[model samples]
Target: MQIIKLNNGVEMPQLGFGVYQIPLDETEEAVYQAIKTGYRLLDTASVYGNEKETGEGIRRAIKEKLVTREELFITSKLFILQTPEEKATETIQYSLDVMGLEYLDLYLIHQPYGDIYGAWRALVKAQKNGKVRAIGISNFKSAKMIEFVGLNDVKPQINQIEINPWYQRMEDQQLHEKYDVQVEAWAPFAEGRHELFENPILSEIGLKYEKTIGQVVLRWLMQRGIVALAKSVRPERMAENINIFDFELSKEDIEKIAELDMKKSAFFDHDAPEQVEWFMQRMLETEK
Candidate 1:
């Protein structure tokens, strides 16, 4: 696995397994299979309601000798409802306890809502207390990102966002670069939207590298220094996703793929008022 150093001087896997919506019961098996398939980084979040199972999977993998605790880079995010310093700190501990881990490889403020300043402060405190190795945020646009950095003593080390050939996020990438924050792609395949798996251009580029379209997309992100997360419950797909390290896409091929950019997310736009309302409702439900 290739490694990237965070601005805080921590090493992270350039590629990882994300358990975004993986079923709770199946998460353990999927994570176990991922570990057996050579994936060392696992991303989960409190809102997924599967951190316990994710932890169970890691324990199973370790018990079976598939991997060790130290070899794994475990990540989880704080929910939007838990942004206050007290609530955020408690939530972080809850995740750690549920995962049965002493420290997380990384922890992030999951969204750009609620009391983000307090939430970031909580994360920074956790980092100082050694409960987390690195701190960052997700789904934050450029303006919020800049405000976050300006307000905090420790700048965010990573910005996890939607990035794929279809939504290249070139402007956002420039902003992340300007702040020395690493860009980590959430939906690297655009959640298979735009028939990403069947794209002719990507397929043509993959042919040159003897890779699949998914692999080609992942390699493209990695080439541009983005940490890419490719999630799959299927063992075969999990293995296939991580096998991208062996091949390299040429500059011309990458440029060709760049032309496929539509500069938008295939998923929801957090900046939209309706989307914000929906997220607010989610927060309310979580509070209940």
Candidate 2:
């Protein structure tokens, strides 16, 4: 596994397994299988409603002796409702307790809404107290990222945003690099939008390397120096995703794949007003 050291000197796996929308009932087995198949990085979230099950899988892997706790990197998120200093602290403790872990390898504010500054302050405190190894924000675009770095005493060690062939935020990535913030790519495949798996360019590159399009996409992200999170319920696919460590993409191949960029998000726009309002409403509902 490739390891990237964060600004705080915490080393993380370049490729990871994400449990975003996995069903609660299946999360345990899926997580366990992922571990068995050689995945060391695990990503889950408070809103995913599967932290307990995800923890079960991790513990099971340990009990079975497939991998030790020290070898794995586990990550979870602070939900929108938990984005205040008070609630954020409580939420961190809750995630630790529920996930059955001593400390999280990384903890992130799941979204950029709510009391982000307050929540970030809480994360900073958690890092100081040793409850979290690294702290970051997810879905934060360039404008918000700039603001956070300028205002906060401790800048985020990472900024996990959407990155894929279609929505390649290269400019924002450069900004992050300038601030010494590592970039993590979530939804790296664009969630199959525009038939990413079938793209001629990617497929051509894969054919050249005797790999799958999925493999090519992940390799591209790795080449761009972005840590990528990929989720899968099947063990075979889990193995395939991590199989990217071997081959390298040629310079010409990288350029051809770069031409497929649409420079937009495959999902919703995080900067839109309605998107912000909707998240606020969801937070209120969750609070109640």
Candidate 3:
């Protein structure tokens, strides 16, 4: 697997497995299969309600001698309700206790709403105390990201957001570059929206490479220098997601695929107040 060197000199896999909607019961097996397929990074979140299972999967892989702790890059998120300074610290500890790990490879504030500054301060402390190696925020817009960096001592190392052929987030990517923040794609496939699977341009490119539309999209993101998190419960798809290293997209093919950008999210917009309310409600439900 290829690695992206962070500003702090930490090397993260360009491709990782995400367990966003994976059921707790199935998360272990799915992650174990991903490990066996040579995936060293596992992305989970507090709101996902499966950190325990994710940890169990890692332990199972370790018990079977599949991979060591150092070889794995485990990432988890701090939910919205956990954003107040006190709650943030407590939540970080709780995640560590639940995951049964000494420290995390990456810990992100899951959303832009709520007491994010307070939560970011707590994460900074966690990093200082050796509980988290790298800290970041997911789904943060450029203005908010700049505010956080301006107020914090330790700048965020990454900004995880939606990135795909349909939603390229070019301006956000440029902002990340300005801050030296690494960009990670959450919905790399746009959740199969925008007829991504049947795009004539992508289909033709796939035919030339003998790959699927999803593979073409993923490779395009990687070539553009973004860390991508791909989730799949099926073992075959898991292998397919990581099989992107073999072929290279020609410059012309890359440009043709780039032209497909619609520059907006297919899912909920983080900037919308109602969407923010919905996220808060979901986080509250998960906490309850």
Candidate 2, residues 147-197, lDDT tens digits: the string is 999999999998888899998888989999999999999998888899998
Model 3: lDDT of residue 43: 96
- Winner on lDDT between 2 and 3 is 2
The lDDT per prediction is 0.92, 0.91, 0.90
lDDT for 10 (candidate 1): 95
The estimated TM-scores of all candidates read 0.98, 0.97, 0.97
Clashing pairs in 2: none
Instruction: Give me the runs in candidate 2 sitting further than 4 Å from their true place.
Output: 285-287
Q: Is candidate 1 or candidate 3 better by lDDT?
A: 1
List ranges where model 3 is wrong by over 4 Å: none
Q: What digit string (tens of lDDT, one per residue) describes model 1 on residues 186-235?
A: 98988899899999999988988789998999988989999999999999
Error of 2 at 221 (Å): 0.5
Please name the candidate that would achieve the greatest TM-score relative to the true structure.
Answer: 1
Off by over 4 Å in 1: none
